[model samples]
Target: MKTVYIGTYPPRRCGIGTFTQNLLQAMSGKDDSPKSKKGFFVVAMNDFDQEYDYPEEVGFTIRQECQRDYQEAAEYINLSGADCCILEHEFGIFGGRNGVYILSLLHRLKIPLIVTLHTVLKTPSYEQKEILQRICRTANRVVVMSHHAVEFLEDIYDVPKEKIAYIEHGVPDYKFLQQEAKKEFKLDKRKVLLTFGFVSRNKGIETAIKALPEVVKKHPEVLYVVLGKTHPHVLHYVGEEYRNYLIQLVSELHLENNVVFIDKFASQPELFKYLYAADIYLTPYLNEAQITSGTLSYAVGVGCPVVSTPYWHAVELLADDRGILFDFSNHAQLADILIDLLDHPEKRLRLSRNAYEYGREITWPKIGAKYNNLVKEVTAEQLKIPRKKSIPFDIKILPPFSLAHVKRLTDHTGIIQHTKFGIPNLKEGYCLDDNARALIMALMAYKETKSQKALEFCPVYLSFIYYMQNDDGTFHNFLNFDRTFVEEQGSEDSFGRAIWALGYMLDNAPNDSYSQIGKYMLDKSVPVFDNLRSVRSIANVILGISYYLKNNMGDDVMIERLRKLTAFLVEEYRQNSHADWKWYEILFAYDNGLLPLAMLHAADILKDEEVRRIAFESMQFLSDITLKEGYLSIIGNEKWYHREDTRSDFAQQPVDAMCMVLMFYQAYKMTDNIDYLKKLFASFMWFLGENDLRLSLYNYETEGCFDGLEREGISRNQGAESTLAYLISYLVVLEAHKNYYSKYWQQNQTEDLTSNE
Candidate 1:
């Protein structure tokens, strides 16, 4: 139990100040028990009476609040994590309004109050009892120091008896008492008599003094110390008549030595000394309402034999054994108990011992134990109560892309409508069947990772290639020459394409429809080239070089022929293209991908050192001149798309063109040259970095993302070829985390390089 004393200590005066001062000193006097709280905190009012500090030895902690800011205090209290509060209640000092601040504090704190009422009147005014009633209704328990207090509250304040407790004030320290104590107060140097506290008419000091004459006759040297000031309020309430009257009676008794009028105020320590010096302490109070005289309690608390009022408080505490309670109506008889106790030094010593033993129990340790239990109960209940997630919705893609952790709805699939995919220029009735395209994708899947299925697509077009073959080895022109079952047309141009494709697969394609077609191509293709090996044999040259690509045969026959074909291409047709479908196209386009890629590889492997240099120079030349202004353009000249209704730059650019560019990027990756890498990345940034629409290039139309960035409502080219092209570019950047991040991603600039923008 943490002790929180709710009183007016530092910043004010009145009953609360003095009461709290005494309380703090008593509570601070000893160490609290281990099972109990230790700190004695004071929550005081500040500003007008702030800046007061309590000694640490006194265990005082402070909480401050302004007069009108109790609401703020209440809210803070509600969450303060404290146990219980101790309130000092009084009608006058609270400034009325039924002490609503305390009520507010209790409701917000949700804790109990150990209320100590200063006054419990038998008949209170309307405003007085209203305040008391309000405080009583909110209190968990009430601490009344005397029986009269308990009775007055039960009847006048309407507080329930079960809520009331009687815990009397403890003894003041004897050290203070020893200072003011007198030896001759003892008769035969063995008797001492004292009366102390604020003097008032009803306190019966006059009766005590008058009775001292009879007391001294029995014990002649007995001394009565009337040591305390008259009440400050007595002048207004009843006048100085009582003070003058008591002074006159002291003289009339003619026992000046025995009835000493030491009527001056005393300090806290001095008051205790008078009580300790006395063998008998008397407070024969006449007023019925004086239930608790702190001075009276101090006397009995120090175990001095006491002759006090036969009143509600005296009967309740001094308890008929610790002290002698006498009838105030018979002052003469009340003197007899004091006279007897003074004569019996042994009896006085016994009473003093009882008070000291009991006073030690009320030491702070035991009192603090009472406070700790209350805190444990309140906080335990609070902890048991529960509190509600931060966002609450459905998820599509989960973190980590794992099935165990992810939640997915039931409709996702890989295949989609042909329109959704990227096949451009479809005639409504003449669209390529997915059967043809699916085979390509399936083969592409295998080619992507060499998983044994590119063979499937290789056969799919095998029959078409063979149907175009011709006799005399000149080959088909516009259509198939062997159209025995259909119309006649020839495409000898397609002959070289078909032969090159078939021959490449024949040597190393996984054993399946692909290799069989390779055998068929080789069986028919060599003769067409051997007879002429000119334009038609250009296909032979492609086929023969592929044999070199597939194996290190230690034979130069096919490789020498390929060199001758290259010579013929440069010497003859390389000067100009025949048409859109030109042999020169095949010349440049061969080794366009990794196989063309392997041309250099083959040269390296076979130690065809001259060929390796040629391959490197040619590839580099192609990438350089054709890569227009940081972008790869398929047309050797810019004029190719100039005459069209929609230009390559404006309309849907075919995906294959970008794919070819990525192929160059791949070549650059192989070369590791800064120039190639720089151009590649700059053109690629038209996608999302600091360039062109500064947007998604794959989704680029002539305008923006929609319709692949359309203009004039034209659908932009966002086809499969484009998608793959962008993906390839992304891979290039991703593969070089260092270069990509430092150069572009991190906005780092190099001295020799042109700015990326």
Candidate 2:
């Protein structure tokens, strides 16, 4: 079975790059025939602007920061005829914040995936933890070198234990040549102490350097060799500052004769020679968080007795006298341990014997065979599972309807405008915009489910709208929890939303009392529509007026009102819109889909073909921009996208996603097009986890949706606006499922019964 590996490869100086090259070599094994190499290849990751003269096995190259490159790389792998893909996952190796851009490629892969996590932090940043969790979900098996990493994955990241595979870091298969290697490296007369791998400040080389003075005083013939070049990224950004400091410390301590810095990357044969030459391997890493250390593994594998700081990897690898551990940056303690080990040659030999016995299990060939087995197993399982020819146009995959969050956010005063995570933030208080949205959501829930609990919320949210309205019919936008208005006049958007709620209630009220109250408020607000200039405001009012006309078709005054509003919106489209830019405004901002939705409603109400034409044209434009990726990537609210500017990818808000879902639902209803139904479901899924981040914004635990998608991660606050938007989109999808999928199923059932009769 051929496998494709995705990561940094040889000819790049990165540690992960070297590891990939070694893994590929080991997995291909002693069979050097063409059959062994057939169809097995590497998709190398290039650091920004740096290209490699890679071997033919490197099938594709992804620029670290170019997101499009990752997508194209996946397409290449999908068509490469490789049975499975193994990804080497290191946070900084991929592009975007915490390397989030890799998700795009992972999502597109058609083959089975296995990801080897090189680093698993005990305490991770929000983006780091979320990105790792997403990767775990995508991979069929998550490989980690240390058992500590496995525990972290299950406990910290919540990855299932069955999904995780504990595979030790592969080490080179070589015999012990401590004295012979010392002679080959020309250190036969001098006792050698070695530390290797790409040198960085975090390696805590100074502690080892500082410890050398005492070691040399005790054994003047000792040679402390620091092998490998400075880390490439560190060299690029900070130059040789870290290397220089080590040299300076050695100079100040007058141990320059005993200490040596071999500033170059070693070949595998040479690296093993250096490992064999060592009396002991030292990895004085300052942080205890290092989950896996390949350098340390190589030392233990070669039977080189190791003395290292108690990093997570060392603690486990050195446990039960396999090796020795020293305190981080504790030079005196390290020095004392080195002296004792040197004095007792038998103790060092015993440690080496234990290390070699343990290393036999993790030799590169054995580890490679283990990986080969995992790949075959995953590929076979994938082949056994039948592939679905097409996605079903139904809600079978959608989560069940939930209003637990809505109830939590709602008090007698109405749904709170904001939340601190899942809890309602009283300091932010209530807003008419959210209350209007909440009212409409309640009405949809009550209509869809006929739940008395849902019906009960209608009056609560309706009461909030009544409380926010001024005597002039204009509404107050914000209200404190103490029942005081923050503003005398609300924005046109809030006014429009209030009208939408009232109009929807008038058409689908639970009782005559609600209809009477809705009609009274809607009638009082009629004068505001004539003066409405904001396209979004007019669109909201137009939608409300159309809903009102559904119950009052004979009301020509309302009909004229609808006609004038549609005309204004159409005129706005004609004036500001061009062939390339088919929008009511030059810039696309929040709640953009509302514009086309209003026109669609008006077109159906008045049967105006021209209005319908513009609506469809503009809706197509919106869909082309947002749904072009085959998933809903909502227009971000960060300095909104203009006609000629580069569109921002974030922060994507749920309200925008909700608008898309609602608009597409309307489009499907008008055209009976299955494509619209597909787009509608895709937009709705943006809440569940199908968007840019691939991290679910809707928290199932709280049943509350996150506020938005920032570039770094999902905004943690589960505000009322986002939560309400999620519910509204969810209900619309459910309604569509009932109307289309459920109805179709019922039709099939009826035909089956008739045939039996």
Highest TM-score: give the candidate number: 2
Q: lDDT of all the models against the reference? A: 0.50, 0.89
**TM per model?**
0.42, 0.86
Residues 1-757 of candidate 1 have per-residue lDDT tens digits of: 4456666664333335556655654554442343222445555443223455543422332233222344455444445554666777654333213343344344344665678877777766443454466567667777777777887888777789987876665454555343235642333353567887667777888778878787878888777777776764465468778878877887888876777666666666666666667777888788667666677667766667777787666776676367777777677787777777767878877777775566665533454444444445544655675653421111221111111100110001111112332233322211111122222333443444343433434444444445445543334433212223232433433445445545545554555666665565556665655444344336334543554345535546655655555555443434443434222333433223322333443344445655455445555555553454344433321123322232233232323233343444545545655565555554444443222111234332121122232222223333333343344344444444344344553444554355653
Q: Total clashing residue pairs per candidate? A: 24, 0
Best by lDDT: 2
lDDT tens digits, residues 1-757, model 2? Answer: 7799999988987778878877887888655454666668999999867999988888899998887788899899988888899999998888877888899899989999999999998999765787788899999999999999999999999999999999999987866457888888899998899999989989999999899888888899999999989887788899999988888898899997999999898888898988888888899999899999999898888888999999999999988798988888999999999999999999999999999889888988888899999998898888888877655255776777889998898898898999898898999999999999998999999889887788989899999998888777889999998988888898999999999889988888889999888888888888878878889999999899989899899999999999999999999999988979999999998999999999999999999999999999999999999998788898888888989998888889998999898898998888878788889999998987798778788886788899998866678899989999999998898798887876668889999999999
Report the error of model 2 at residue 488, Å: 5.8
Worst 10 residues of 2 by lDDT: 388-397
